[model samples]
Target: MILFKKKPWKLVTITSTLIFIIFVVLVMASIIIQISNYKFDKSQAKRNEYIISTSLLNSGLSFEVAKGDINGIESIINDYLSYKEIHAIEVRKLTREVIYRKQKTINKELRIVAKTYSLLSQYDEISIDGLDKVENKEVKTIAKVVITFSSNYMNKKITQQALFTGGLLFIAVMITIFFLYLFNRYIYKYLNNIINTMNSIKQGDNITLKNKGIYRVEELNAIYRSLQELSETIYKRDAQLKDSLNQAMEAKILAQEAEQFKEDFIRAISHDIKTPVGVIINLISMIVEQSDTIKDNPSLSEKVNACYESSIVLKEIMTELFNFEEFEQQKLIENKTKVNLNEIFSQIKSLYETKFSEKGLGFSVYKGSQQTTQLLYYINIDKGKLLLVLENLLDNALKFTESGAISITWIVKKDSLLIQIKDSGIGIPEDKYKVIFNKHIQLNNISTSTHQGRGLGLFYVKRIIDLLGAEITLSSKVDIGSVFKINIPITSTMSTNTENTLLLTEELSKSNFKALIIDDDQHTCFTLTEMLNKYGIETASENIPEIGLSQMTKESFDLAFIDFHMPNLSGDVIMKKLTSTLPKNTTFYVCITAESSPYHLEKLDTLFHEVLEKPFDITDLQAVLQKALKSKRVTNEVINNIKGKS
Candidate 1:
């Protein structure tokens, strides 16, 4: 049998048990008191017997003996001795003889017995007095009065009191136990609820105790109120923090848009500058190539060659700057696809072979010895950007190497592709190797006469490789050679064909198509119209979206180039209006602007036939125009067939 270990049960049981024990002890105490009272009652009865017998013997018998009236003495003794509590009584004269004696039970020295205790007789001596005579104060005992009490006289009464006390004790214990049980259920249990709730909350158990009945205690109510306030405070602070973070994010996005605009302006200016500089450089090249006409003066021819090279160098710097801007700003999104390393290398080899031949340097490409025969040199990547990086490295190798060979080695590992472009040219100094990749950095040992680039080639290469999520390392010695290694992580080992990006199609391959240009900028609209006219495409221009849309609604074109950021109406809204009202055959939609956010672009992709980013070249423009023409033709065919069936 286990005693209660829980607090409520323990309190109830201990209290109830203690009350019961106290009741039992009190009952026992009461019994002892009753027994003591019995003894006192017996003593009192003995005292009464002594007084009564002495009075009767002294007054009644003494007077009678003096007056010679023995009848009265005998009557008093007989009357007193008739009491039941008086066990025996005796009256003796001065002669030591029993003059009057009465006995309920025979005994020499009287003893009375109750159920569990005994009582002895009491004796008292009485003095005799003469009737109407002088009192003898010094006289000895004349008569004796003796009395004994029956101890069993009040035994039944005492036993009844003990029984009554036991009954009261039992009732009290029961009532106390009832109150203890009630305290456990009503008070202690709820207290336990509070304690248990606190413990549970301390352990991070989410719960709520309704203060409906639980808040009966004022102190507990105060505690609960404080807890609620604390939780509310924390929640409010958390909400404020979240709101602050959201505001910060919005500010960052706005700042990003501002930066994006600046980069877009840079891109447009670079493209505009590149086209004219390219023409200048080409005209200078023509002058150099046809220098025989001017060979009458070799000094002038040499100066013209210098001007051509300077023009060419200027064009190269502009192109490199534009590429660096694109990479740095992440404006050029990578269009990744499956590619064959062998094919990409072949193209790179062909491109570098021309440069190498011009420079009279040897160049070759091969798989590294570490590459396994079982492995496939297939990787998914942005083929154009990857080619750009290889081109830059190979170009650098050509520039540095005068007569030595440049070798490109690649190894297809299980997880990555390792490519190294090693040159037997003037190697970089050990300390300058890392800094060689920095923008505008030139080595001391490299030839100064043929360094046409502005030292941005390696920097641009590194940034482009970073955009590819690849790693590049350079190893070089002062006079030996430099090895530039690039590691590209492989996503899959499955064999794949090289990706071909041929955006021109038959429908719009020719430049004799009609097009509409819509933009807010007058210069941009005019420039685009001029460019399209140069391509032999009949072009219309509108600087406002409303006018552009109105023009489109009135007169149909083969393709409509709408700017996304217009005055009142956005490009997407225009697409929606056109999609709803305009016949699919009449015009094909094209988004042509600098909206480069992925979210906006993805949304536009669903609406436009194609997205033509701003600052694109003639080739990019041709590709988008071709797509637009193809869609327009397809839509027209579908409608014509539908009309024919109808």
Candidate 2:
């Protein structure tokens, strides 16, 4: 409404007023010139006719006198009158000496009379028409005839003059208007287009023009040139601004990537350092335990164990930090396959029985009513990695929980398997429940239980859950308990199962088994061989898979420990070659370099019977060796566990 009340209406008014003024000026000037010319033509025609009539009458009289028609002057006049060319003629004897007068009469009373008849003499006429000199001189020869030549010529002259003058005036006006129209079309419209383009620029739209031809106007053409330059400048500036914005955005993304990389690097280093330190502390504790067995040393044992426990706590913290870092980096791998949570839970329960019994904590498992022995487990996950996450959670729960029940439940939600682990430990602070799954974070309010950890169990659990694209939530109250719920999407496919179960075919328990160990690192091979020798397995080292394979072919070895990553060949190749040569009854253990790769274990199942992750403890290695020793007499359940799903 405001715009309508503003410049548009004003512009319309000015343009219309200018057109009206030009039209009126042109038309009025044309009319005035035509009227003046009409009046002038009438007056000029009357004067011309008067002079011609007076001259003709005087010349006729002079011709009669020169021919000596003194007495017959009237007769000569009458004879000319018969031609009807001279309107009337009169010859009078004036001063008794044949002075002649010729009068061309008009309207019988008004005449153009000439008194001097000589051929070279001048004649004059007055407005009072009677001849004064001939009136007193006599009527010796007098004949007067009248002819009038009035034909409205003055009116006709005025009409023709008006038409000619008006036509010329109209032509002048038309030419002026045509040039004016051309000026508006070429000059005015060009200027207006420039003005409109400027307005569009001010409003931030692309500027362009339709140039029909070069403008005749100097000012308008100059403005057109200037506008083109301005448009180019504006376009270039806009492009530069867009480029600057893009650069800033790219810089921002690069900075964020660098920051995330730094966090992940720190986390990985911390985890790497902590694992070895934990191993050293646990080894020292084991040594102290052995020394205590030979002598009474409770204080020393407790001190050494406490040191070992501290190292375990540090290891947990570092592991959780690493998991969080990987989660943030989106680098955590999810090796999804169906898993039997019941089978997993059963093992956990059995492992925790001794610990729970010592702590006076009741632990039990209630199998669900589902009739499927295989449990129809369809979970997408890395089974070993997930189990580690659950192991940490359960370990923390059991440690904190003295004289209270720890339970594991598997309930079905829509299209999901919801696993719940609840404990009756000194519960978490309600406010801290949300933060409990973060690395290095601990609950300050739980002061009753003598549990120790780096507060990383739940964090690793959350990371594993996230990697699986699952959901986990925590609920707790002070002095009551905490419940952790995990939901994983389930399908109908069977999961790959890999568990070591073995039976001895012969009674050769006391026989010393020779073992060959191959690893790139000398310290790793020596340490592993020394630990195995104490377990009654005599061991040797090749330090590389190729040499180990060459040595194994030459020597009749009972078993081979091949590192998954070696200088000469990968453990998979060694396992493949060994299984091709050795009998199916023979056992091979493939040692892994890192715990992150579950596919390696699945691959190992194709050749070897057992696969151990690096930095395995003495007890874990002892269990693997025992299983290998009893491989020939394994039960169906044991075989099924060892042979992963194809």
Write candidate 1's Cα lDDT for 1-646 as tens digits.
2233544333333445566667667776876787688778767765765565445534445555445455776786577667767666555555656655666766565446421111112213435432233345554444555555565546566767777876876786687778668755766766677677667655545555567643344454566666656555655676787799999999999999988788778745754564456445545644555568667788888788667657655655565666676656666666565565766787578546756866778888898675444543566776656867887788788777777899988877787888899998778888886788888888875737776667878988887777778899988886678899899876745532221223233224353467888877666666666556544678888888898888888886887888777668988898888878774445667787554444556788798877765444444565566456657667769889999999
Give the TM-scores of the predictions, in the order they appear. Answer: 0.43, 0.48
lDDT of each: 0.66, 0.60
lDDT of the structure predicted as candidate 2: 0.60
List where candidate 1 sits over 4 angstroms from the true fold.
Answer: 1-168, 171-511, 632-646
Clashing pairs in 2: 62-117, 336-381, 337-381, 503-630, 504-630
Q: Cα deviation of 490 in candidate 2 (Å)?
A: 7.4
lDDT of 1 at 372: 48
lDDT of 1: 0.66
Instruction: Name the TM-score of candidate 1.
Output: 0.43
